[model samples]
Target: MWEKNGIKKNKAQNYKCTDCKKQFQHEYLYWGADINIKRQIIKMLVHGSGVTDIAKVLSVSKGCVIRTLVKTGTQVNLKSSKKYYHKVQIDELHSFVGKKEKKVWTVRRAIIYAYDAETDEIIAVTAGKRSKKQVKDLFKRLNDLTIDWFCTDNWKAFKEVLPYERHLIGKQFTKTIEGVNTSLRNSCKRLNRRTTARAAPKFLKESL
Candidate 1:
């Protein structure tokens, strides 16, 4: 069926399988336009195009574009093996929903940023809902192997919830987190104006 649609088949070259040893034709299957569309989607994403924009350009649904991107293995890197930043920053940002007439609803998300303050390199990011319990849970889910200092603004929730593990609160201590919040806000168009309907919570979380 695929071969009838211009799919090409090549001889299996240097191919070995543990389950079975067979020399079968390796076929590449796709419609010509699909290849172009996929490349366009990837290129747009590389150029910092939002998912909605990519979908519009490709004439596909936003969900389809998102799933395709995920299938293509494009995702944010959240792991840092090196203990580059002993001190981490924490903050929260809110997103609003609803249009001109209806009252807007707000949803808050917590952002945990690990950064090398000296080099200004963002090492890792963890996001969750804005709540003492949620923030504490986020920390608990982290690998406790690294004992680094945590700094945040005088958010009383941090003082009460974060474990006694070298945490500090003060204006100076939270500068990095504040900077991160600014960067994150600007990166996602939905959050830039503060009045736009928030992106789906799951998508926003994944974007982090």
Candidate 2:
């Protein structure tokens, strides 16, 4: 697709599935995202572009981008399952669903992530409601790592789930992961508090 003003959009082409006798677009290498829209969406996400900007430039609907991100994004894992780290930090970021009514935000969700502090590499990331179970699940994933220190904020779940000796709770030691929290808010529209681009839990989870 290309615009009348000579602005090129996606170079995507379509094909039919031989077995299913169905047509599909080749841009996303999957269904839904057509005309190379997936590539554009990914690039926009990397550059910290908001969802509205991405949809406008790529010539796709906001809903289309969100659905595509959730479908394909969830299938790919960022962290290698076999790798382990030494020192790590854990933190949570917040996002909300729906709109504020009567001067109140509803359906709040938390985006929790872990990172290797020494290497400054992310280990794990997920989105869910703020609860003890969320913290437990995140810690459980890091069980494979050869962890020495686990730094976090003064969240009570961190104290309960993590080993007393290994867990380190203080702002000083958690600067790196804290910065990541800021970066997440800056990069993704759903993570921004004041933005109209809210997200459902499934979409937030995959987006993270």
Candidate 3:
């Protein structure tokens, strides 16, 4: 519980997970952070602040910053479908993830995005491998949209999932989504090359 002066009024309750038997604090404010402070942390993160940078800015511990990010990242509504659109562009971005003593794991964690041509908006984003099944699943999420045309690279999945009449296979047609990929790589440290911010699949997925 919190008091009128914005300080904690009661001791945190401890609850154990049924399956894991792990004790965790059940606090009203996540990690004992004030609501305003949490919002400021989120804003800083969106504006390209690294975890350590955010921690320093807020005068908090690095672990606090990381916990806030993990809590906020996974809570996002990623699968919300948009309204109908006539023109859309789709593309995939592949990158490496995971690690081992002998060798690093070369995973095909592709970021599939759909860009609305007329409005210059990114309507959808599905992160997974560049496979036929995943591609079809992404389009299925956008089935409500009346897409008359789709611009994409010469990926065989596009040809297999969508009708040829509606699909335009060319790099020239997918400049916007490519730009988005570049922006993501530039803004996110984990997505950058040769960075210590690299993460495994689960952490990477949530971070992005």
Instruction: Provide the lowest-lDDT 10-residue window in model 2.
Output: 1-10
List the candidates' TM-scores in order.
0.53, 0.63, 0.57
Candidate order by TM-score, decreasing, is 2, 3, 1
Tens-digit lDDT track of model 3 for 1-208? 3222223346555455666554444455443366567788888878877667777667777777767766774355444345667768898765443443333211324557788757777776665556898788778878777778888899889899988888888989888778877778678643444455543599776885
Off by over 4 Å in 2: 1-35, 80-84, 95-108, 187-208
Better of 1 and 2 by lDDT: 2
Query: C-alpha displacement of 186 in model 3, angstroms?
Result: 2.3
lDDT of 3 at 76: 53
**Model 3, runs deviating above 4 Å:** 1-45, 49-75, 78-82, 96-108, 193-208
Write one digit per residue (lDDT tens) for candidate 2, span 1-208: 3222222245555466666655555346333346356777877777777667777667678777766556554465556444656668888876544454422211234667788766767787665667788888788777676788888999898899889998888999899887887777777665665765455689787885
Q: What is the alpha-carbon lDDT of model 1 when measured against the actual structure?
A: 0.57
RMSD of 1: 10.2
Task: State model 2's lDDT.
Answer: 0.68
Error of 1 at 125 (Å): 2.2
Which pairs clash (backbone N, Cα, C closer than 3 Å) in model 2? none
